[model samples]
Target: MKYLALWFFIIGVVLIVFIQFITSQNVKRLTEGNKRLLAEVAIQNRLRLLQNDVLTVESDIRGVVITDDRTHLSNVNDKIESIRREVSALRTDLRGEHAETYITELDTQVGRKIVFSQAILNAYDSKGKEAGEAVINTGRGKVLRDSIVQAVHQLDSIRQYRLNGIISNIENNGARARFMGVGLAIIACLACVLAFLYVVNKGRQQERMIQMLNESEKRIKEGAFIKEQFLANMSHEIRTPMNAILGFTNLLRRSSLTQQQQQYVDYIYSSSQNLLTLINDILDLSKIEAGMMHIEQTPFSLNGLVSSVQVMFADKAQQKGLQLTINVDPSTHDTLSGDPVRLTQVLINLLSNAIKFTERGFVHFEVRCLSQTDDEVVLQFRIKDSGVGIAPEKRKAIFERFQQAEAETTRKFGGTGLGLAIVKQLVDLQGGTIHVESEVGKGSEFIVRLPFRPIQNHTEAFAAPAEAVLNPVRGMRILVAEDNQMNQQLIRHLMRQWQMDHVMVSTGREAVEALRREPFTAVLMDIQMPEMDGYDATQAIRGELRSDVPIIAMTAHAMTGEKERCLSFGMNDYISKPLKEAELYAILQAYFRTADAQPAPAVVNLQYLRELSLGDTEFENAIVRQFIVQVPEELGLLQEAVQAGNKGQIKSIAHGMKSSVAYLGLTERLSPFLHRMEVEAVSGTDENHFQEDYEEVRRVCEQAVIEARALLSTSA
Candidate 1:
C-alpha cells in the first residue's frame, strides 16, 4: 500500500511538471511569433513611406516641368534620400527564399528613380523648364515611378505572406499547448482522487482497530473486577474456617499428648501457619497494589519487636541443625515510635525466608543503629543467611510479586514470592529502604534501614505481675455471639478456663435477644452470622436498645481496616478469630483492669553451657551458680550506673556482661537491654527506653535465677 501511494504521488508530480512544460512552450512560441510579426510590420511601414516618397519625387519633377519652379526642386533631393533609406530597411528586415531578390530589385528601382529625379532637377537647372519638361514628357520618370511602385508592392506581398506564416505557427503551438496542458491536468486530478481514496480507506481501517481496542480494554477491566471480587470472597471464606482450625490447633498444642502425636500436631500447626502467612502476604500485596495499605506510628519497644521475630524462626533453625543468631547494636534505641506491626512483618518475612532456604548452614540477624537524634533514630536491620544464594542475573526479579530467583526456586523452595514484595512495600510506605546482596550458590544478605521516632519518658499503661494466675474478669458477665460451632467450642474452653461468667449464642439475633433480656459487662460479637449479621445486631443494640455496653468485634475478615470498620459501627473494640488467648484476656483486662495473672517466665536455654561442658556436670553446675550470682549483682551495678547517668560505668558493665549472658544462652535476651542502656548513657538521647530495657532485664534475670535454682536442685 505504501508503495502504491508513493507511485501515485510520483505520478501526480510528473503530471504537474508536464503541464507547466506545456504552458512554457506555448509562451516561448508566442514570444517568437510576436517578434517576427513586429519586424514584418516595421518593413511594411518603411515600404509605405518609400512608396509615398517616390510619389512626392515624381510630383516635384512634374511640378518643375509644368510650373518651371526651381523652389519645388529644392527639397526633391531630400525625398530621394528618404526613398534610399526605406529600401535599406526592407533589405535588412526581409528573410525568406525570395526575400533578398525582392529587396535587391526594389533597392535598384528606387535608386534609379532617385537618380532620374536628380537628373530632371539638373535638366531644369541647366536647360531650363522646356528641356526638363520635354525630358519628363518622354514618360521615362513615370516608368521609373511605376517600376518603384511595383517593386514596393512585391515586397509588401512577401512581408504579408511571412506574417501569415508566423501567425499560423503561433496558433498551432497554442493549440498543442492547450491540448497537452488540459490532458495532463485531468490526469493530475485523477491522481489526487486516488490519493484521497487511499487515505480514506486507511482511516477506516484505523477506526476499526481503535474500536476493537476499546472493546478489548473494556473486557480486560471487567476481568480485573471479577478477579478482585474473587480474592475478597476467597479471603473471607478461607479465614472463617481457618480461624477455627488455628484456634483448635492452639488449644491442641497446649494439651498433653504422646511424642509422635506432638510431632504430628507440630506439623499441622506449622503447615497451618505457613498457609496463613501466604494468605496474609497475598492480601498485603493486594492492599499495597490498590493503595489501601497505610503505616501507623505507634510507640513500641524495638528490642521486644525484633526479639519476637528472632524467636519465630529459632525452632526451624534448630530443627535443621543450623546456628541461628540475632544481635542488636548497643547504641540502638529500644523504644521507638513507629509501625510495630509492619516492622514485625518485614523482619519475619525476611528471616523466615532465610531459614527456609538455609538447609545446612547458619542464619544470622543483626540490628544496628545507623543514626540518631534527640527525638528520632534510624536503625539498620541486616538479615544474612548462608543458604542457596540468588543468581546475579535474577536478583531484581525476586522482589516482584509472584516472582523469585528463577522458576526452579519456586519449584524447589515453595513460596508465592510475595514476601519480598510486601517487605519492599512496607519499608517504602514507612519512609525506609531495603536492598539485597547475593552470590549464586554462596549466600544472601538483605539490608533494610528504617526510621523511627524515639519514645521518651516511657510509662507502662498495664503491667502483668509475675506471681500467680488470677482471672481479670472472674464472674464478670460476658456474652458471646458466634456462628461456628468449633469456634464457639474453642471460646467455651477458654471462658471455662478463665472462670468467667459467660453465655454463648450461635447467632447475632439470639445474642441481641439475650442482651435485651439482661445486662452484660461485654459482648463478643462475631461479624458474620446466619440470621442477622454483627453489624445489624450492633445497630439494634445501640440504636434500638440504647445501651452502652462494650462490644468487642470478633471476626475472620482480617483486612487492613477491619478494626476501624467494626469501631465505626458502634463497636467498642475489635479482635479477630482464631483469636489469641492472651489478646482476648488483655482486652478484657483493659476494660476491667483486675488481672493478677502471672507473666510466663522466659525459659532459660542452657544449650551453650551444655556445649561448653562436654558432659561435665560439675562444670555445668559451677557456671549455672556463677551465672545466678553474677547476673543479679552486675544488673544492680548497671542499674546504679544508669541511675547516676554515668556513661563510662554503664558501658563498662554492659560490655563485661556479654560472655556471662552468652554462657547461659541469653545474649538475645540481655544484649538489647544492655545495648540500649549503654547507648542512652553515652549518646544522651533518651533515658526512658534505657529504664524500660533495664526493668525488663531485671525481671527476666530474676526469673532466670528461680528457674536455674530449680534446675540445679533437680540435677542434684
Candidate 2:
C-alpha cells in the first residue's frame, strides 16, 4: 500500500508538471499570435482607409466638374488630411520584409492622386468646366488613383500572408503540445493503476488470512443483506404479477363460463392467491427482521376484523373436517386504534396455521380485553387448535423461520413452516408478544397480547365489499401510467367494466406529457418504466408541471414503508402491482370524491354557441335543445356504423358529430377521437383504441347534454 501511494504521488506530480508545461506553451503561442494579429489588422485598416480617402477626393473633383456643385469639394482638403494621416499610420504599423518599399510607394502614389484631384477641382473653379473635364479625360488622374490602390493592396497582401503563416505555426505547435500532453497523461494513469495492482497483489497473503479469520462474521452480516434483497426482489418480481393474476382472475370469474371451466379457473385463482400469501409471509418476515415493519394507528373494529378472518378460513377449516370459530368480548371497544392490515395479517396467519394443523377438533379464535383505560386497551388473542402439538423444548424454535415442530412434520404435513414465524413477527411488530403451550399428543394454543388505543370518536371502521363500494357518480377522465402490458390490459378492462374513462400511457414521461396537454381527474403512475419512473414523474408533475392531479403510485413493490416512501415522493396513494381492481378504484374514488359532483373543466364551452346566437336567446335555446336531442342519436349511429363497417355512414356521422362538438366548444377534446373514427372508417386498422376513444366521446357528450338541458330549463 505504501509503495502504491508513493507511485501514485509521483504520477500525480508528473501529470501536474506536464500540464503546466503544455499550458505555458499555449499561453506563449496565443500571446504571440494575438499581438501579430492586431498589428496585421491595424495595417490592413490603414491601407483600406488611405485608398478610400483618395477615391473620395477624386469623386469630389469630378462632381465639381460635372454638376458644378461646390458642396462636393467641401471635404476634399479634410479628406486629403485624412489620407496623409492614414499613410502615416500605415508607415508605422507595417513591418514586413518589404515594409519600407511598399509604404514609400503607397505614400508617393497617394500624394500624386491627391495632387491630380486638386488640379481638376482648381481647373473646374478657375479655368471653367471644359478645362476640368479635359484634365479628367486626359486619364492621368485615373492612372494615379489606380497606382494608389495597387500600392495599398500590395501592403495588405503582405500583412495577410504574414498573419496566415503565424496562425499556421501556432496551430501546429498547439497540436503537437496537445498530442504529447494526452500521451503523457494516459501513460501516467496506466502506471498508477499498474503500480496499485502490483502492491495489492503483494499484500494479498495478509489480506487473505484476515479475510479467513472474519469470513463467518462477514457471512453473518451478508445473510441479512441477502434476505433483504430476496424480500425486495420477491415483492417486485413475484407480487407484481401476483397482483395482476388475482385482479384478472377476479374479472374472469365474473364472466359466463361452463361449470368445468369455472371450476378450473377457481382452482387456478386459489393457487395464485395461495402463492401470493406465501410471498407476503416471506416479505413480512424479512421486513420484521430488518425493523422495516410499521404499525398504523388507525381506528378499526375488532369484531369486524375477527369476522373477516373467520370468513377467510371457514371454507378451508370445513374442508379439513375442522370448525373455525371466533369470539370477541362485548366489552371490548368497538373502535380500537391500531393497524387493521397488520392485525388482520397476524390473525390470518395464526388461523391458517390452526386450520392447517388441526384435522378433527375446532380451531377456536377469541379476542378478550386484558385491560382498558381512557384511551388505550390491552387485547388478548387466543388461537387454540387441536393440531399436532409442539414438543416442550421446541415451542420457541417453531416461531423461528423455516422451523417445524419435527423435521418430518414438513414432509408429512406439506407446509413451509413460515405461517407461525410470520404470525409471531407480525405480533411483535405491533408492540405485542406471542407465547405457545402444547403437548405432543394434544393441541397447541398460541396467545398474543397487544396494546392498542381505543377511539373515542366512533368511526365506520370497515369498508364495504369492493363491488358494493364502487358507485362512481360520473366517469372521470383518468390517466394511467403503467409499463406492464398485462397490468395495463387488466386496468383497462377494469376501467371499461366500470364505465369510467381512462387513457393509458406506458411511461412516466408520457403520463406527464399527456397531463400537460389535457385535464385529467387523477394520475396512476407506475414506479418502474423506461423513460421515467413513477417517483420522478410525480415530482415532474408536482415540482415542474405544478399539477396536483392526485398522483397514485402503481408500484410492484409492496414492502414495508413503500407507501410512506411513495407519499414522500409526492404521491397521493399507492397500489401494489398485479393490481386489485377494487383497491385501485377505491383509491381513485377517494381522490375524485368532490370531482364526481362537478362537471368536467372542458365539459361544454358555451362561447361557441353564444357567438352563433348573437344575443338571440331563442336561437340559443333551439340549438341547445337540438344538441340534447340529436347528439346522442348521432353518437349511437356512429357506434353502429363503426361496428358494422359502414365506411360511408362512419365518415358522414363523424363529420356531423365533429360539427356538433365544435359548436359546443369541445373541439380540442372530442374532435381528435371523432377524427380517428373517420380515419378508422377509411383505413379500418388498429386493435380497439378507437372503441375506447368512442367511449370517452360518449362520456363527454353525455355531460354536455346534461348541462345543456339544465341551461334550457333555467332559461325557461
Candidate 3:
C-alpha cells in the first residue's frame, strides 16, 4: 500500500510538470511571433508619420506662397526636419532587404518633397505668391509628393498583410491554448485526486506499521520475562546439588579420615568452589547487562580494604613461591566513602591474575593519594607483576568478557576470562578508570584511579571487632526452615557439629508452628518453600507470635537485590546457599557471642551511628531517638500504601528508610525485606504477593523499633 501511494504521488508530480513544460513552450513560441508582428506594425506606423510630415511641409510652403507669411515658412522647415528624424528612427526596426528598400525609397521621396517645399517657401519669401505658384506648377513638387505617398502606401499594404497573418496565427494559438488549458486543468484535477488518495493510503499504512511495532514490543517484553525466569530456575537447580557436594565434602574433611581421604575431599571442595565462582561471574555479567547492578557508597577504611584484598591472594602467591608486597604512600588517608566491596573485588581480580601468571619474582601493590581536599579524594592503585605480559594489540581485548590475550594463555593458566571484564565493570561503577602498561614476556602493571568523597574531620576509622572466644548457646533451641533435603541435612550437621540443640523443618509453616510451640534462640528462614514461604512465616513469627528472636535468611538466590529482599521480610541477616563453613560460623557466632559477654542481648550494632555522630554522645542519642520515633509511623504508612496498591509510595518510603537502616548498621537485619519491597514495587505485578511482602516488612520494622529502643536505653 505504501509503495502504491508513493507511485501515485510520483505520477501526479510528473504529469503536472509535463503539462506546465509543454504549455510554457507553446506560450514562448506564440509570444515570439507576437513580437515580430508588433515590429512590422511599428515600421509601417513610422512610414506613415514620415509621409504625413512631408505632406504637412508641402501644405505649409503652399500656405506661405499664398499668404506671404514668414511663420508658415518656419513651420515648413520644422516639418521637414521631423520627417528626417522619423525616417532615421524607423530604419532600426526594419529587417530584410525588401523592407529596407521600401524605407530607403520613402526617405528619398520625402527628401525630394522637403527640398521642393523649401524652394517654394524661399520663392514665396523673396518674390511673393506668383513666383511660388510658378514653382509649384512646374509639376516637380507634385511628382515627389505622389512618389512619397506611393512609398508610404506600399509600406502600409505590406505591413497590413503581415498584420492579417499575425491575427490569424493569434487566433489559431488562442484555440490551441484553450484546448491545452482544458487538458491541463483535467490533469491537475487528476493529480489532486491521486495525491489525496496517496495521503489517505499512507496514513493507513502508518497505522499498520504502528500496530506491528506494538506487537513486536509485546513479544520482546514476553521474551525478557522468559529469560529472567530461566536464569532464576537455573540458579536454583545448579546451587541445590552444589550445596550437597560442598557441604558433605566439608563434613568429610572434618571427620577423622586418612590423609588420602582428606586430600580427595579437598579436591572436591576446591572444584566446587571453582564452579561456584564461575556461576557467580556469569550471573554478575548478566546483572550488569540487565543494568540491575548498583554501586554502593559507604564509609570504609581504604588502607584496610586494600590489605584485606592483598590477604586474599597471599595464600595463592605463597603457593606459587611468589612474594607479594603492598606499599602505601604516607599522604594516603585511611577513611573514605566509596564502594569498598567492589573496589576490593576489582583489586582481588587483578592480584589473582598477577599471581597466576607470574612464574617468579615479586608482585607489588602500590597505593598513592593523587589529590585530596576537604570534600573529595582521588587515589591511584597500581598492581605490578613479573608475568608473561600481554601483546600490545591484545591489551584491549583482554578486558572483554570471555576473551583471552592468546588462546595458549587460556590452556596454560585456566580461567573463564571474566575476571578483567568484571574488574573493568566494577571500576567503572565507582567512576574509576583502569589502564594497563605491559610488554610481552617482561611484566605488566595495571593502574586504577578512583575518586571518593572524604570522611571529613574523621579522627578514627572503624575496624572489625576482635574475635572473641565463642561458646555455644547452651540449652537454646534453634529452628531451621528449609525445603531442600540436602540443605536441611547440611544445616543440621553444622548445628550438631557446633554442639547446639536445634530443630529442622522442611517448610516455613512447620518452622513457624515449632517456633510458637517453643521458644528458640534464633530462626534460619529459607526464602523459597512449599507451604507458606519464609516471608509469610517470618511475618507470623514477628506479628502473630510477637517473637523477637533473631531470624537469619537462608536462600540459593545470590542475586543483586536478594539480600535486601530477605532482610525486609523480618530476617536479621542473610547467607547464600552452598554456604561456606566460615560464613555459617560467623553468623552463628554473631548471635551466640554475646550470650557470654554482655549482661543483656545487643540486637543492633551502634558502631556506624557512633562514627557518624563523631563522638558526640548527645547527637548519637538524638539520632537513635529520631529513628525510634519515626520508623513506626513510616512503617504504618508503608503498610497503608501497600494496601492501597501504591507501589510508588511504598518504594519511596522503603528507599528513604534504607539510608537510616544502613547508618545504624542494621542493614543485615532490615535491608533484605525493605530492598525487596522497593524493587518489587516497581514491577507492581502479583499484587497479593506484594501485599504479603509489605506485611512482612511492616512486622520487621515494628520489631526493629522495639529493639532499637532497647539498645538506646542500654546506651543511655
Q: Which is the leading candidate under lDDT? A: 1
TM-score for all models, in order of appearance: 0.61, 0.49, 0.62
Candidates ranked, most accurate by TM-score first:
3, 1, 2
Q: After superposition, how far is residue 543 of candidate 1 from its true place, in Å?
A: 9.7
How would you encode candidate 1's per-residue C-alpha lDDT over 443-502 as one tens digit per residue?
899999998987442221222222222223355778999888888888888888888878
Indicate the TM-score of model 2: 0.49
Candidate 3 lDDT, 369-394, residue by residue in tens: 99998888999999999999999999
- Range of the 10 consecutive residues with the lowest summed lDDT in candidate 3: 460-469
Q: Write the per-residue lDDT of candidate 2 for residues 1-716, one digit (tens) a residue.
A: 67667877688678868877887887788788888878778767767877777887888778778987777666777888888887777776654567689789988988888788778877877889899999999999889888888887887888789889878877887787788778877777777777777677768966987898699778867887787766766678776677778878878887999999899889989899778777777777777777777776654446545644554565577678887777789898765667777887788777877887777888898999999998679999999999888899998898888989998887887677788888877787788999889988688998999999875532112221111111236758889988887888888888898788999999889998998899898888888788898888889999888987888887778676777889899887676776655446545655654434643343666665565456878756766655665566666666765666656556556655765565556777787888887777677665535568778898878666656654553574
Query: Per-residue lDDT for 419 in model 3?
Result: 87
Looking at model 1, report the run of 10 residues with the lowest lDDT sum.
458-467
Q: List the residue pairs that clash in candidate 3.
A: 564-671, 564-672, 565-672, 567-672, 567-673, 568-672, 568-673, 568-674, 569-673, 572-669
Give candidate 2 misplaced runs (Cα > 4 Å): 1-230, 373-376, 455-472, 593-716
